[model samples]
Target: MSQPSQALQIRTSDGIVFDVCLEVAQQMGLTHSWLQSERGDLKCSDGPDDDANVMPLNRVRSDIFKLVLDWCQAVQTVDTPLEHKEMLQHQRSLFQRILTESNATDSTIFELIIAADYLNIDGLLQAGTQHVADVINGCDSVEAIRERFHIMYEGEIDE
Candidate 1:
């Protein structure tokens, strides 16, 4: 007999709930060291308790969680069937659009960084960090960085 599909329930800080495949959920959990026990069981050693089957991510916003989930899904599916090159390209285009749409502001990027770090999603963390670096790299001076990131400098500027 075919086995029933296994799923993992995720509950975000904003009370948003969603379901993902058990494999993907395990992947997400594996990124955080504390989530695994000595025997490699999915145990929350220093983290929040699991609510039945729902893993509560109380520090992550729902929208940001959604983006992180999308990133995870994209990374997981990057090696689809070789015959579906066109579909793969289309998926990549969608991923790029989503990244661009989310990267519209410094605050958004900051939120993404926070979410990625909290969720222990390494790919998103790297992407968010690189985006911040790219923004900083494009600036010519401290003033430009401040302006680009909308930072308020209360101290006197060095000549």
Candidate 2:
């Protein structure tokens, strides 16, 4: 049998600790960089009790970080590289399910985008920005797009 995956602890800005597998952690650019750094000897262990190993993420909130972790875990399940079209299809389906299940708002989605960008998770960033773009593209008019994002129009000021 294969060995159990090493647990990597991450602490969010909200002081929530999440124990993630090494595979998922390695997929995150910032975390992967840390894993490769000489000073990045995070106490990788099988158990989550070791608080000293926790990587603190100052910009990511627990709720949003949880979503990012979930996304990485789910995406990692597909071992093989998929075609471009297939990847887009899978991403769309996964994103739709996440949105429906979480009942996420536009603000939350935007926050997730920011968190993903901060973490340098390219796949997640693409998916989130694509989702926002798709939403705007589907809008019937400029007013609808503004309404969707809760943007209010102000009169133009003199240049």
Candidate 3:
């Protein structure tokens, strides 16, 4: 069953405001509910004043957010694809690089992958998942991936 939607006001880093549905806002990273929005608009974790370059992060560091948005724009427009703006193999190579360097790189790529998944960006998701799968299917065992990603294992008994 779908959760009941609520009203919410959100401000992006650019100072632009949006009257977002509560459910969509909940999709964001934070423990919040309708109660918080009762009095007035709530300042979110990704508020424009948020310091992405500093401690408190803004939705996928500012520069990375712009990069992801650029990728989205290029991928979404049919004209852009047909215009041969970027080759498919080139895009795959980029995703592959992001997937592999997930540890060394900033969290922006993962955030972008999550956003793409939520938005039903299948191409990006597949590419990202493949990159992740490659990591898992590499010399590292299943236990390695779990350890790297911090997943609690409950299925296996102690050896």
Regions of model 2 farther than 4 Å from truth: 38-40, 44-51, 156-159
Relative to the true structure, how large is the alpha-carbon lDDT of every model? 0.67, 0.83, 0.50
Q: Report the lDDT tens digits of candidate 3 across residue range 1-110.
A: 99755545443444444444554444443314333444344444476455321222234344443444445544444444433335556567766654455443424556
The digit string of per-residue lDDT tens for model 2 on 102-147 reads 8899878999999989999987888889999999999999999888
How many times do residue backbones clash in model 2? Answer: 0
RMSD of each: 6.4, 3.3, 11.7
By TM-score, how accurate is candidate 1? 0.71
Q: Is 1 or 3 the stronger prediction by TM-score?
A: 1
Best by the lDDT measure: 2
| Candidate 2 least-lDDT 10 residues | 38-47
Model 3 earns a TM-score of: 0.42
TM-score of 2: 0.87
Candidate with maximal TM-score: 2
